[model samples]
Target: MLKKIDQAALFLEKNQQVFRCPFCHEAMKAKDKTLFCSNRHRFDLSKKGTLYFLKQHVKTEYDQKMFQHRRALILNGMYDPLIALLAEKCQGERVLDVGCGEGSFLHLLEQQATLLPSVGFDLSKEGVYLASDYNQKHFFCVADLTNLPFNKGTFSTILNIFSPSNYQEFARVSQSNGQVIKVVPRSGYLKELRQAFFPEDLAKQHYSNEAVIAKFQETFPKMERKIVTYTFEIPENCQHSLLEMSPLEWSVTKERKEFLQKNLLSRITIDLEVLIGRFSADNMKNM
Candidate 1:
């Protein structure tokens, strides 16, 4: 399955220009059609219609089962409002999704704007495989955030949703007028799971709002932040994936999982904060 996907990805790279090397962050040159660096580093485009730019191997916490769970929850309309909000806010011809798992948001964006061209990347090869299967038209690749394998100023807009941020890399690839939309979990994002696992410490050490704001401020000077909160009734059948996609999955004891399964509620809250910012070269002085 992976080999087939890689083949398809290589086919898609035919007309694409050699941008930056995902490993050394150096400029890449086109040898025939494949991208190669002076350091003798070579990365071939997959035949399946995507790029394979992952040079340094790193284990990802996400897996097929976790992404499958996330797909179920997202398709359940739990985050539809957030998706709509993102679709409305983003404006550009080309959009890149960093840490885009399974291309759910890309699917949502396609539904909203069929004309928009989008690309998604993730560290997890499994996730990229699934994303390519989900949508063959839009490009999906197994790439890293810290060292994106694209040319500088190639993207008009970039998105990081419930994922890590590499601001320097983001700034390097994004156009001067481009915007970076970051979706973060707000307070009580997964309250039910927290309730089940950390009942004893209900009020302590939640997802930090201050930290998110400070981090965004540190990265971009001129930015706007919006908080979005919504309630969804999670069905009994969907509880497993919802739990699996969360950190609570790792922290929960076996007994707690059983407990959550047995007493899972049909409703939960999906709260998020969308931080939208435009890069300003002058902003670097603030740092």
Candidate 2:
């Protein structure tokens, strides 16, 4: 019988044709604990049982502590409705999560038996480690989105949620008829937090998705966007994470951070737009 790690590895092996060396852009073969290419460039399998496919080191505010808090919120069902919608629209034998943070979202889908083979990749080692440690049913990797390691037309569906996206890379790795699902924040997202952080700066309380939407529209030929907004009552104990889980709080001062950390939000607004679409004619020209 195969261990969970091997099972996940088998998923990679089955799709090895789509994987390439980050250094040389050559085909990579999966061995026991590493992936090697003809050019002799190699990548190691992490101790956490996931792969590391990056060409360089990464620096970011998304450390282990931050990912821990975000994972906690996700496990608590903070994004259940959104996840449900994603799972429903996502139909494919294999699913690839681009910029998948901490792996909570995909892990939850695996628990709910909504995935065939879920593979998650993020630039943050901390996030990928959290995901790999939390669940063994799916494959997680530390990867760079700008130059993905997968071959042309690898995944039937790709997901980009609350993370940066590279349309060109996405198109190169996705199947000819692949679907891309992207979630962008609306102005009211975390309105309570905005209000608390900037009590006086009225402009700081709102956000806009105009540029993001337009970019997505330009990237994909056929696309539609939907607005999902609601006021979710916050549990008293969960308020700390609700504030800390967002990157928006990274710029906050120590004094303000302590205040928000101690205080609780009664209700938080969840405003977001879900963009479901396909690659444009120009992108599909690669097919």
Candidate 3:
């Protein structure tokens, strides 16, 4: 088997045109195990076959343990229905997952549908590191969403699922015929969990995607919107993982956490809206 660095080197060499230097905005080329721009700003793949586009270490609330829980939930098929919906909307040969936490969604999407050259990047080093353990057919990197390391018109399908987005950067890196599939949580998403933990907190109990939806609609006026809502029964093994997987658990009180951990939730509401649209650089410029 090829060494991890060798695998990443091969990918970078084959797809060098997809990238530009995050710092100087110059085109970059892969040389053996390293990627370097014309100005000699270089990045190397880690031993685990992942690359780093981040200039400095970024501290995020998402740690390795949380990613582990998230990955467990994914592998256990918690997101299969949502993944199927995403697969149907996917088009073109290249897919880029923005804010790809743990890389499970991208990895599973390819598994459930046609194989494509997929790339996933996240701000969390732990998330990217865990992602590299997925199929070698996909590439994972630690990158900033505000300053993506990809060149213009690189990806045909861009996925921003339950994560943050940079619309300007998304428009810049998207192909003319490309589509962006963004999934935002609905008010009912994880309603049970929220109520169990923060019953008195109305703001925490309800979520509105109106502002986010409005912004997306403004950016892509003729976008298609689909609401996918379902309740997934939590398996006995995944109950604890479900509790700890989301950022919601981070702020819960100690008593609530302990109670939820022991009592466990039977199911979770998966309510999300998948917005699909062809990005117009002009529209984004106007915004």
Candidate 4:
């Protein structure tokens, strides 16, 4: 039996810290089942226990179907080692995931340790809804990374795994002593998918390792990078889901899909680069 989160009560309890009115940057405080700002701005919490405070809306590429596919793949332990490595890196005071699709990583973290406090935000409403259903204790919201409705210096640790990066916004919301753990896909990731999709050209696209180093070096004085690679079998039934989980689905035509299904590959490579950066006052000054 899963506990249903009362969005209103949860919002009231955590709204002040979790949300800030984008209009005035005033903390939203719950009063009489409504969230209000000091400047008299008010927003209602949804019946389902979530709030929509996005300044603007943008269509997300990852949708319900994509998340469903990802959920299946993740549940099969495709990225277990990466999750474990991240769990080891996190000190877990106040963790925020920028693009937490369906709350898989957050759920994994919950299983691994008693974290301090965790919150996940994503552009997809469907993803947030699904995440909330998965765990009531962990807060999940539909929000954008480009313009997060959070006060500066809020999060202790930020996680951006295989998602877009808004480093400027991330820096603004992160505490001076906070750290960011970002995971980027290496060239070898999903090599089999590429092989199945484009058998003729198997040339691996080289990753820009120097570009990653240079970008983080501009942000943090102390940064560390680690490479993690593993192999996972994608069952025949799960192959369609895995195909749908990636952009390759679009790139690979129906003929290709049918061809791959006929001669389906059983396993694929999973390679990722994890970058951890610690922010300092000096680093802020440099920026």
Winning candidate number (TM-score): 3
TM-score of 4: 0.89
Cα RMSD (angstroms) for every candidate in the order listed? 3.2, 2.2, 1.4, 2.4
Count of clashes in candidate 2: 1
TM-score of each: 0.86, 0.92, 0.96, 0.89
Q: How would you encode candidate 4's per-residue C-alpha lDDT over 176-215 as one tens digit per residue?
A: 8789988888878887787777777555333445576578
Error of 4 at 157 (Å): 0.5
TM-score of 2: 0.92
Tens-digit lDDT track for model 3 on 1-287? 87767778788888888889999999999887888999999988899888888878889999999999999889987888899988777734589998898999988888767756779999999999999887677799999999999999898888999888788888888888578899999999989999998978988998798999998888788999998999899888989998889899888999988988888998999998999988665774653
* TM-score: model 1 vs. ground truth: 0.86
Per-model C-alpha lDDT, please? Answer: 0.74, 0.79, 0.87, 0.76
Q: Alpha carbon lDDT of residue 127, candidate 3?
A: 93
lDDT ranking from best to worst? 3, 2, 4, 1
| lDDT per residue (tens digit) for residues 27-65 in model 1 | 776544366777878876555445678656667888888
lDDT of 2 by residue, 1-287 (tens): 56556665675676567688877789988777677899998876666777878666888789988888888777776777787777677644467898888988887666554566667999888888788765565688888888888887888788889888888788888887788889999988888888898888788888688898898887775797878888777666677887778777877788988887667776788888999888755667743
2 or 4, which is superior by TM-score? 2
| Clashes per candidate (backbone, < 3 Å) | 15, 1, 0, 1
